[model samples]
Target chain A: MLDSESPTKSPMKTGESATRATTRDRLAAASLWLPVVILSVTATLWSRRLPAELPVEWLGNEGGAFRSTAVFSGITGTFALFAAVAGIIALAGVAATIRPWLVLVAGMVGGSATAAWLVAAGFGLAGEPMPASAVPWMVALVLAAASYGVVPYLLSSRQRRVRLGDAAAGVPLGVGEAGAWFTTIRVRVFGVFAAVSTLAAAVIAVLLVPRDAVGASAAIVALLLVAAGFLVFSRLRVSVDHRGLRVVSSLFRFPIAHVELNRIVSARSAELRAAEWGGWGYRVMPGRTAIVVSGRRGILVERDNGTHFAVTVPNPDLPVALLTTLVSR
Target chain B: MLYKVDPASAVTIADQLAVQVRVAVADGSLAPGTRLPPARELANALSINMHTVLRAYAQLRDDGILEMRQGRGASVRADAAAGTVRLVELADALLAEARKLGVGIPDVLILIQKRGTHA
Candidate 1:
């Protein structure tokens, strides 16, 4: 399964220090999201009352029905925007072996812009202008909170060990030995986000949706719900271990693959498909197509016996380099 | 002694370093504790990315073949000489060269001995 030699181990002292620093940086980056969530919740709860006190008068009454329904939809849209931005910032923070500072900068810019847009949209829908001075501060808070949350997650979840072995013919495989704890925590967190976002969308649809347009609202809400669900699933992650690739999801658990590297033909990313590749959770590209589940890039393996394995991955460059090294050896 | 590195090798900078270090150590050209260039300087000298050099150093360290300190740079480890790959191709090439030159095996051995003693 592997070379006759024992696999190398990272230095204890240096590895610990590097892991700690990485964790600290990720936490700093993730903290940028706190303000965003807080502001969103606060805006949703108090905006109706707050709108009355604004310097600018609220425009057309449009009656209570229109006002209530419009406000509810706007808030849901705002939440969606916030969640998307948060997800982007979090992913960007830990995408590769990027410098902490660079991730921080990217998170701040991305999170703040999206938040600002959301706030502006909210203001327009409410027929009011945003408080100019307050907006930037709110955005800054969101940025800081996001850094704090994301940096630690990155640090704690960093892959520490790997297990090298031969995968079956025609299966592109990676086995990581240690660091399951990190991967577990990550999966749990994403699960929480998914569940929360999904529940929020569901609850809002049930409570605020008008009675007359039940059919239409049901369709709209269902679409939004699906998008929210997929958004959460897309962020799920699992680590490669010696036994196989550990698959962690809110719904189920299993080892995704235990294939060999030599069998892999080519790897690439593709959109989710249900029937051909088992409904979109995370699929190995079937047939001639190696489909990566949610990641932008995937590794594809075509065995000599006409079977295939494909896995969605974050940074194809590093894994690709590692694969090349192994294959050449 | 300085060795030239090919600019367009398919090998990564770290891989190149590992290969060079392994060969040099096996040949006794670079002795243990011999200080090497800083990662930054080596990256600059080779015109490769800094992270590439860092990854190489990390790999070497992981293998217990290289020692790196924050400001002290890198050096050969104390116990790196145990592992070596004997190449039949080089031995055959040398034997063929000696026969072509009409040199006896003992004379070839003596010349090799002289070069080693002088170095």
Candidate 2:
């Protein structure tokens, strides 16, 4: 439902340049496919260097060499399976909000490191305590975590430079008059997940508390609670005033997103379904991104530079009214 | 509920807030027993003095529209009479019409007295 929406104007402003993802971005993301074929061939060749059987698990107490063996083809098939999974993610990324390249890199990072342990075992490092195989796995994990952020910044067109637009304003403020609106949205989706996760952790502690080593049990419980807290994603505090629209996290009070008044073209209250806009949390599409939570009352803000940013809030009318007023000024 | 304040307006900030609550109560948006945002949170959001919000709460409590406790924050009283809210809304409409017609509350009161006594 649209309320207090601005009057429709021409579909495209006459002097405006079209904003979009660059060719470089699409190619850089799609280029990830090359590795899939390359790895397929490489893994086929690597199996020839291996023996007739392989370690059943890569990270046993003394590492993979200590575990039971599996046929050589089985090991190669497993490695190829992971590579195929990564390729599928890359292919699907073009149509969805999830970045294809980032997920593919993560899959490869995990697949290749585990492959290293299997390769080491086949080439006569099969026995005599190969504990060091764990090192490459850990290193791969760190790299994968870092690349979640690094690869997107280096190769994607996620954050494009934006210029001011001719904003729309309607609500009037008299001379020396100012208005501000505020609301907090609790993300029920993430909150329920967090609660369930915490409850599971609590049940685990209850079962384990009867045993000795209270310190270890307590540590595990604490770690799980912290993870649950993170799972909350965030309680978003949104406000609109003379400074424009600001969204901040309730936990850290850190600014999650902001749109300056000068950059806003128009704004209106909407009834949004979070699933339709790409799941809860911050979602980025071609030229728009939406921050959705419990997901009903939302504000859709169209920016001057041909981009849009939407946020789900508990009470969107006040902000929509305030933003429309400020943008018009 | 929609809450807004115009510092330049003749109405005090507290009265603006209290009236918004009354209007919301009358419209049935703020249901009986619904909890209102804490005064500090409201103040922080609007960039207004915290005491101003407290004063609004105090007025609401005196009007029997809200219940406040030391630790539980504030909520609309379950028994908050509808007649009071209806009167508040009617008074608001009358005051608005009077303001638009370039008349004062005393003039409206005089007219109300003349009409009220007749009815």
Candidate 3:
């Protein structure tokens, strides 16, 4: 269990702050146009060296092969796809409304697609025969990019501690003492819909695809989607005790927010509209993060570090009061 | 901070909420100028009528322990500490005396008013 009295404030030293600022600036600059610049330079150089027409071969599954002469070089199509991906990434970086998950997903898919295309073009340009299958390489690149995005988020969320045994122990009923209150909000409608849809898609993919490496890959993707949907639609359980506020998932018991009583500056009831939060499950914005479900009434908590968190629940007052009382104590 | 209200208790829900707030203020859990939660939201969480929360807030406001403004909501008064201590003492004494003399709250109120006018 995490000590409730641990320091919540993370004031940066001058040197560290400056270093972080510089790093952020560099990242922002790179995100804006680095990919596009690299793609443009490669395209310009390759276009000048490539022939106007190239022979392309297509190998069919039933032992049939065909060759066709392209009007434009193969590099042209590869460069075009690369440019589109770069443009999308740059735009997403600049747009405030685009969710980080959307950007991450796009980056994974687009980055892998561009990488595969570039590799194929490189082989063609070198007068070497193209690989029979690029599926495995693309899949590996996609997985790598996805892990890069997801692992950090998962690690950060795990930092919030949820001590079920300690929390339960802290709530003994006594005269003039407040006992722990626990409530679970099951998102049944969304959970059922998402689980059923993903499962059905996985079944369809398994049945429709031919029994080959490509078919196996499609089936794996569908299974992953099913797992993701289940995680997304799991029930949210909240508990308040002397230790502080704890919000965890019912299915996995992963900590969403476990704000210590000492770290809480204040809490109050809020009316959270999905529109304001950009239609959220978990929304990360400029200065605040929120966990939104169905209800408009929610609890907004301000921590000692000046970060704000909001969670939509049917009853927000009890937690607000509990937090206020604990902070006061 | 934990606040609990039992629906089955003999004490009214509004009174329970008021007592909790008063105890918090008196014990220095709620510092001066600290804002309280909105009545509607509190009521919703407690599953009680909104008016019950408003009544508790009004009681606190009348006691000079809280200051309620139009848009700013409720907050503990800057001088609430001294006032709260005095109020708690007087409340204890009055309740003891009323119980000892078998006198109701209304009779005690009437007696205090009459004595105030004469003084």
Q: Judging by lDDT against the true structure, name the best candidate.
A: 2
Task: Report the C-alpha lDDT of model 1 over A1-329, residue by residue, as the tens digit.
Answer: 11111222211122223223345445545555554555566567755644332221222233453244345445444544554354445443223322333444544444544454344445645666546666556556545534443443444344421111222221122231111100211234445655676676676667657555546566556756665555545433333322222233423333334455455443222221233343345443223333335533344344456665555554333333333433433
In CAPRI terms, model 3 is classed as incorrect
TM-score of 3: 0.41
For model 2, residues A280-310, the per-residue Cα lDDT tens digits are 6787866777887765657778889988788
Candidate No. with top DockQ: 2
Off by over 4 Å in 1: A1-212, A216-228, A245-247, A250-297, A314-329, B1-119
Weakest lDDT window of 10 consecutive positions for candidate 1 chain B: B82-91
TM-scores of all candidate predictions against the true structure: 0.24, 0.62, 0.41
lDDT of 2: 0.61
Chain A TM-score compared with the true chain A, each model in order = 0.28, 0.56, 0.46
Ranking by DockQ: 2, 3, 1
Which DockQ values do the candidates obtain, in the order shown? 0.01, 0.25, 0.06
Between candidates 2 and 3, the one scoring higher on lDDT is 2
Q: Which candidate would rank higher by DockQ, 2 or 3?
A: 2
Q: What share of the true interface contacts does each candidate keep?
A: 0.00, 0.22, 0.07
lDDT (10s digit) by residue, model 3, range A142-214: 3463343332122211112110111101222344444444456667776876677677667756665555545
